[model samples]
Target: MENHEDVDIVIVGAGLAGLTTALALHRLGLRSLVLESSESLRTTGFALTIWTNAWRALDAVGIGDSLRLKSTQMKGFKIASPDTGLFTSEQALDKDGKFKGYESRCVRRKDLLEALVDELPPSTVRYSSKVANIEELDRFKLVHLADGSILKAKVLIGCDGVKSVVAKWLGLGAPVRVGRSAIRGLVEFPNGSGLDPMFHVNFGGGVRFGFVPVDEKSVYWFFTFTPSQVPSYEEDWKENPMKMKQFILSRINKMPQHAQDVVEKTSLSSISIAPLKFRLPWNILFGNIVKDNVTVAGDALHPMTPDIGQGGCSSLEDSVVLGRCLGEAFLNKSNEEDDEFERIKKGLEKYGKERRWRSFSLISVAYCVGFIQESKGILMTYFRKAWFSSYTPSAFLKMANYDCGNLVS
Candidate 1:
């Protein structure tokens, strides 16, 4: 056990949400300590599609330009039928011919993480500091780490992800599984493969496969299937890299040669399975978003399906808005007329009320999209395509253009 170090806020987890919160606090001239369980930063993952709204959030925190250096801008999204190779719907990358005022980009996850880390001062993040328990005292919150070190802070922000200890301590639990499993991978493709730079989603009966260009030479692909049964996490499961690849290929074997060729070239070692799950009472923005002086964000609050690729985006938005709220609280404290603790508490409560509805709505919308994409019936398939074709491009843009800043006020 080590001596406890106090700070304004202590963030648990060093993933996207945690780091973003740390950065946001830094911008507000507040110091935060980020505790990461992993010894080092994560590397080796597929590209992340940062939609326009996310881009704006990143820009607000001052890392947007750095991210742009390592990203590939996406022109738009395409939905196609695997059976006929016909485009069911195609939306332009920008409806007003302006990248919708925020160009969407696909950047490698590691690259983005590294960029954020580089902007922070040394010791801002404490590696291998896994939090085992949290004890909230009247004056301060105590974060008990796995190694027996105790950290006390005025506020504790849990960015610990879906199975969050902080959330559990605050009475939150595992989210409801949506009965789907996602298999994802990043792979290189041979030249002249005819894959478009735009994002692609091809639907088949009960399964959907997707592709997004990560760069000029590499593409990230994923498939979601309606799993008949959920598998328990086991050591043997970790050893099989080919499981996801085999599952995807077997399910989509009857698709066109182009699709099959891509799948055939994918190595099992490059794939990972993510169980699709969602929580109705979004932990960070709803439910117990804040208990006492502690709060949560990102997947720690709302872990939505990746159908819309807004998981990371939503987390970034959370950090920005939370930072703003905290800033306001501090500013109010400077006037000496109001109590600091009460001001901060009221700020967080307002943040929760404003952010909860939108966050849950997005989660629900993504769930619906996933369900429709994986429908088994022929009638459902026809309706899905019909809806897609008839849906206005402006409506799709409006959904993507949703800004968290607008919700904060």
Candidate 2:
């Protein structure tokens, strides 16, 4: 390895969590080296549903307004069964009575990532640098990159996704599969899809189909089902794009005419599959999620099922919380090189204390919701129709009520 370069903090993985952390730290006047495995920034993952809390978090680190300009404001969520066009329940996106006035938006992931990157200094992100190994020392963590360079930092924040090397190094176990898979894509209607601007979902045949009008010209859609075998990686789609495409077509072909139209027009190049995986909530609650100055964030910390659309939202939340904790730690101490290590330990501990129970409870709820929706039993179907439609919206509202607090930077 080349001679090691030391910094105060090193954030692994330049995805949503990593980029947010870097920007948050910068706002706090702290510089970080964000190491990304990909040769360049990710421009994939067509679009994501960002709820009210996420908008606040984005605003905390600066960029909420920019994203707002690029997104189609989602006012409500409609849930119903595909067979019957009748709606079960509709949750309005607002803060009143039981709900907070947090307007959810669906924005393209690539646009958001690019926005986050643009706010950072030119040298903030290092591309083509993957973490091959992590070795923890008494006062510092040594991050070994694939390019034979070493990054030594007083604090190591692992945002490296579900298959995280940093988490493995910290003794956290592998992510648990939720026994389901998703095929998602973005359909372009350069001439406008002529659909109402809202997020909608239909459940039937043990599958969940969802669509959100990201904008007038494009709509984001997904089909989630319990696959016979969950693919280990994104590339393991068992490549016959046509086969996967047809399988998706068969599943959603009978959905609403609008839904069917979106499915049929799914971009073959954009259609992608993913095996849903999550970390055990108990592991985060009772296990070693934090070790001294080394801790994990985002998927590295809590990879929950995306049924509630909170996986990325919670990951983005982590950056704000982690940044605040670290800022307080640094603000409380001197820049004296001697005690910098202790400051990081304190910061990470505070972050762990703040995040543990919140993430655990959310993960449990997400897993339960997924189980409820995916159940094939007639009783379960009745329960879902009678209960889920009414209860879930309130639960999500309670979740949005959470404020990660201001970044104060």
TM-score of each: 0.89, 0.93
Which numbered prediction scores highest in lDDT against the true structure?
Answer: 2
Least accurate stretch of 10 residues (summed lDDT) in model 1?
Answer: 388-397
- Across 202-281, the per-residue lDDT of candidate 2 in tens digits comes to 76567888899998888999888887633443444565576777766677665567777887887789787887899987
- Write one digit per residue (lDDT tens) for candidate 1, span 34-99: 999999986656667888888888888889998887666777777776566555567666564654
Cα distance off (Å), candidate 2, residue 129: 1.0
lDDT of 2: 0.83
Candidate 1 wrongly placed segments (more than 4 Å): 1-3, 85-88, 95-99, 190-194, 229-243, 253-256, 281-286, 389-396, 406-409
